[model samples]
Target: MKILVTGANGYLGQGIVEELSQKSNVEVIATGRKVDRINVDVKKIPVDLFEVKDPYNYFGRPDVLLHLAWRDGFIHNSPAHIDDLPKHYSFLKK
Candidate 1:
Protein backbone atom coordinates (compact mmCIF):
# COMPACT_ATOMS: atom_id res chain seq x y z
CA MET A 1 0.00 0.00 0.00
CA LYS A 2 1.19 3.47 -0.82
CA ILE A 3 1.03 6.04 1.96
CA LEU A 4 1.84 9.71 1.58
CA VAL A 5 2.69 11.62 4.74
CA THR A 6 2.71 15.39 4.81
CA GLY A 7 4.85 17.40 7.29
CA ALA A 8 7.20 14.42 7.28
CA ASN A 9 10.02 16.55 8.65
CA GLY A 10 8.20 17.55 11.82
CA TYR A 11 8.86 15.86 15.12
CA LEU A 12 5.78 13.62 15.10
CA GLY A 13 5.96 13.23 11.35
CA GLN A 14 9.54 12.03 11.48
CA GLY A 15 8.72 9.33 13.98
CA ILE A 16 5.70 8.19 12.02
CA VAL A 17 7.64 8.03 8.77
CA GLU A 18 10.39 6.05 10.44
CA GLU A 19 7.92 3.49 11.76
CA LEU A 20 6.07 3.23 8.46
CA SER A 21 9.30 2.76 6.54
CA GLN A 22 9.92 -0.47 8.42
CA LYS A 23 6.76 -2.05 7.10
CA SER A 24 7.53 -4.41 4.24
CA ASN A 25 4.16 -3.96 2.57
CA VAL A 26 4.07 -0.20 2.82
CA GLU A 27 5.42 2.31 0.33
CA VAL A 28 6.04 5.56 2.19
CA ILE A 29 6.15 8.95 0.52
CA ALA A 30 7.38 11.69 2.83
CA THR A 31 6.51 15.28 1.99
CA GLY A 32 7.10 18.57 3.82
CA ARG A 33 8.23 22.14 3.39
CA LYS A 34 11.73 20.85 4.14
CA VAL A 35 12.49 17.16 4.01
CA ASP A 36 16.16 17.27 4.99
CA ARG A 37 15.30 16.44 8.61
CA ILE A 38 13.69 13.12 7.81
CA ASN A 39 16.15 10.31 8.56
CA VAL A 40 14.07 7.50 7.06
CA ASP A 41 14.80 5.90 3.72
CA VAL A 42 11.80 6.77 1.59
CA LYS A 43 10.66 8.94 -1.29
CA LYS A 44 10.90 12.46 0.12
CA ILE A 45 9.20 15.33 -1.65
CA PRO A 46 9.68 18.90 -0.45
CA VAL A 47 6.58 20.89 -1.37
CA ASP A 48 4.20 23.54 -0.21
CA LEU A 49 1.21 21.48 0.81
CA PHE A 50 -1.11 24.45 0.56
CA GLU A 51 -0.27 24.79 -3.12
CA VAL A 52 -1.09 21.24 -4.12
CA LYS A 53 -4.24 21.10 -6.21
CA ASP A 54 -4.53 17.37 -6.45
CA PRO A 55 -2.60 15.76 -3.65
CA TYR A 56 -3.32 12.16 -4.54
CA ASN A 57 -2.13 12.50 -8.09
CA TYR A 58 0.58 15.00 -7.24
CA PHE A 59 2.13 12.59 -4.76
CA GLY A 60 2.09 9.54 -7.01
CA ARG A 61 -1.50 8.56 -6.33
CA PRO A 62 -0.93 7.17 -2.90
CA ASP A 63 -3.55 4.85 -1.45
CA VAL A 64 -3.65 6.82 1.80
CA LEU A 65 -2.81 10.37 2.80
CA LEU A 66 -1.70 11.24 6.29
CA HIS A 67 -2.18 14.98 6.57
CA LEU A 68 0.03 16.05 9.44
CA ALA A 69 1.20 19.35 8.01
CA TRP A 70 0.54 22.47 10.04
CA ARG A 71 2.19 25.81 10.80
CA ASP A 72 2.87 27.36 14.19
CA GLY A 73 1.29 24.36 15.85
CA PHE A 74 2.99 25.01 19.16
CA ILE A 75 1.66 28.52 19.35
CA HIS A 76 -1.88 28.22 20.63
CA ASN A 77 -2.94 31.56 19.20
CA SER A 78 -0.80 31.80 16.13
CA PRO A 79 -2.44 33.81 13.38
CA ALA A 80 -0.91 31.60 10.76
CA HIS A 81 -3.33 28.83 11.65
CA ILE A 82 -6.33 30.90 10.75
CA ASP A 83 -4.61 32.53 7.82
CA ASP A 84 -3.91 29.21 6.17
CA LEU A 85 -7.27 27.68 6.95
CA PRO A 86 -8.62 28.35 3.49
CA LYS A 87 -5.58 26.92 1.78
CA HIS A 88 -5.80 23.79 3.83
CA TYR A 89 -9.49 23.46 3.12
CA SER A 90 -8.99 24.02 -0.56
CA PHE A 91 -6.23 21.45 -0.76
CA LEU A 92 -8.37 18.88 1.01
CA LYS A 93 -11.39 19.68 -1.14
CA LYS A 94 -9.52 18.54 -4.20
Candidate 2:
Protein backbone atom coordinates (compact mmCIF):
# COMPACT_ATOMS: atom_id res chain seq x y z
CA MET A 1 0.00 0.00 0.00
CA LYS A 2 1.07 3.60 -0.58
CA ILE A 3 1.51 5.21 2.85
CA LEU A 4 1.68 8.93 3.32
CA VAL A 5 3.45 9.70 6.57
CA THR A 6 3.35 13.22 7.92
CA GLY A 7 6.15 14.74 10.00
CA ALA A 8 8.33 12.08 8.38
CA ASN A 9 11.36 14.26 8.93
CA GLY A 10 10.88 14.30 12.70
CA TYR A 11 12.68 11.81 14.94
CA LEU A 12 9.75 9.45 15.40
CA GLY A 13 8.54 9.94 11.87
CA GLN A 14 11.94 9.18 10.36
CA GLY A 15 12.28 6.03 12.40
CA ILE A 16 8.88 4.77 11.29
CA VAL A 17 9.68 5.45 7.67
CA GLU A 18 13.03 3.71 7.87
CA GLU A 19 11.62 0.57 9.44
CA LEU A 20 8.64 0.42 7.06
CA SER A 21 10.65 1.02 3.91
CA GLN A 22 12.64 -2.20 4.24
CA LYS A 23 9.56 -4.37 4.05
CA SER A 24 8.71 -5.74 0.64
CA ASN A 25 5.71 -4.32 -1.29
CA VAL A 26 5.26 -1.24 0.90
CA GLU A 27 5.74 2.24 -0.55
CA VAL A 28 6.51 5.02 1.92
CA ILE A 29 5.92 8.67 1.18
CA ALA A 30 7.49 10.97 3.75
CA THR A 31 6.44 14.56 4.21
CA GLY A 32 7.25 17.35 6.66
CA ARG A 33 7.38 21.11 7.01
CA LYS A 34 11.07 20.87 6.24
CA VAL A 35 13.25 18.21 4.63
CA ASP A 36 15.59 16.03 6.62
CA ARG A 37 19.25 16.85 6.16
CA ILE A 38 20.29 13.22 6.22
CA ASN A 39 19.93 10.95 3.22
CA VAL A 40 17.12 8.41 3.13
CA ASP A 41 15.53 6.06 0.59
CA VAL A 42 11.86 6.92 1.22
CA LYS A 43 10.03 9.50 -0.87
CA LYS A 44 10.43 12.93 0.81
CA ILE A 45 8.20 15.97 0.51
CA PRO A 46 7.89 19.31 2.29
CA VAL A 47 4.46 20.70 3.06
CA ASP A 48 2.75 23.06 5.49
CA LEU A 49 -0.45 21.37 6.65
CA PHE A 50 -2.26 24.51 7.72
CA GLU A 51 -2.09 25.90 4.23
CA VAL A 52 -3.69 22.79 2.80
CA LYS A 53 -7.44 22.40 2.47
CA ASP A 54 -7.27 18.65 2.21
CA PRO A 55 -3.74 17.66 3.13
CA TYR A 56 -3.94 14.20 1.64
CA ASN A 57 -4.47 15.59 -1.84
CA TYR A 58 -0.76 16.29 -2.05
CA PHE A 59 0.04 12.61 -1.79
CA GLY A 60 -1.60 11.85 -5.12
CA ARG A 61 -4.14 9.32 -3.87
CA PRO A 62 -2.46 7.55 -1.00
CA ASP A 63 -4.01 4.29 0.15
CA VAL A 64 -3.17 5.05 3.76
CA LEU A 65 -1.93 7.99 5.78
CA LEU A 66 0.04 7.78 8.97
CA HIS A 67 -0.70 10.99 10.83
CA LEU A 68 2.37 12.08 12.78
CA ALA A 69 1.79 15.82 12.94
CA TRP A 70 0.20 18.14 15.48
CA ARG A 71 0.26 21.92 15.52
CA ASP A 72 1.95 22.77 18.80
CA GLY A 73 3.26 25.81 20.73
CA PHE A 74 2.15 29.20 22.07
CA ILE A 75 1.95 30.56 18.56
CA HIS A 76 -1.14 28.45 17.71
CA ASN A 77 -1.92 25.39 19.77
CA SER A 78 -5.51 25.22 20.92
CA PRO A 79 -8.86 23.99 19.63
CA ALA A 80 -10.03 27.59 19.69
CA HIS A 81 -7.25 28.55 17.31
CA ILE A 82 -7.49 25.50 15.08
CA ASP A 83 -10.08 23.14 13.65
CA ASP A 84 -11.69 20.57 15.92
CA LEU A 85 -9.54 17.47 16.13
CA PRO A 86 -12.41 15.04 15.59
CA LYS A 87 -13.69 16.99 12.60
CA HIS A 88 -10.24 17.35 11.14
CA TYR A 89 -9.61 13.68 11.60
CA SER A 90 -12.94 12.84 10.06
CA PHE A 91 -12.09 14.85 7.02
CA LEU A 92 -8.99 12.78 6.51
CA LYS A 93 -10.81 9.56 7.35
CA LYS A 94 -12.55 9.84 3.99
Separately for all candidates shown, the number of backbone clashes (residues 3 or more apart, or on different chains) is 0, 0
Candidate 2 all-Cα RMSD? 3.9
Candidate with the greatest lDDT versus the true structure: 1
lDDT of 1 by residue, 1-89 (tens): 99999889998899999999999999999998999998878999999987777787899989888888889877889999899888888
lDDT of 2: 0.72
lDDT per residue, candidate 2, 1-94, as tens digits?
8988877777677788888888888888888787674256878878776556666676777888888765552346476336546544664665
Q: Cα miss at 14, model 1 (Å)?
A: 0.4
Write down the worst ten-residue block by lDDT for model 2.
72-81
Cα deviation in Å at residue 70, candidate 2?
1.8
RMSD of each: 1.0, 3.9
Q: Model 1: runs farther than 4 Å from truth?
A: none
Model 1 scores a C-alpha lDDT of 0.90
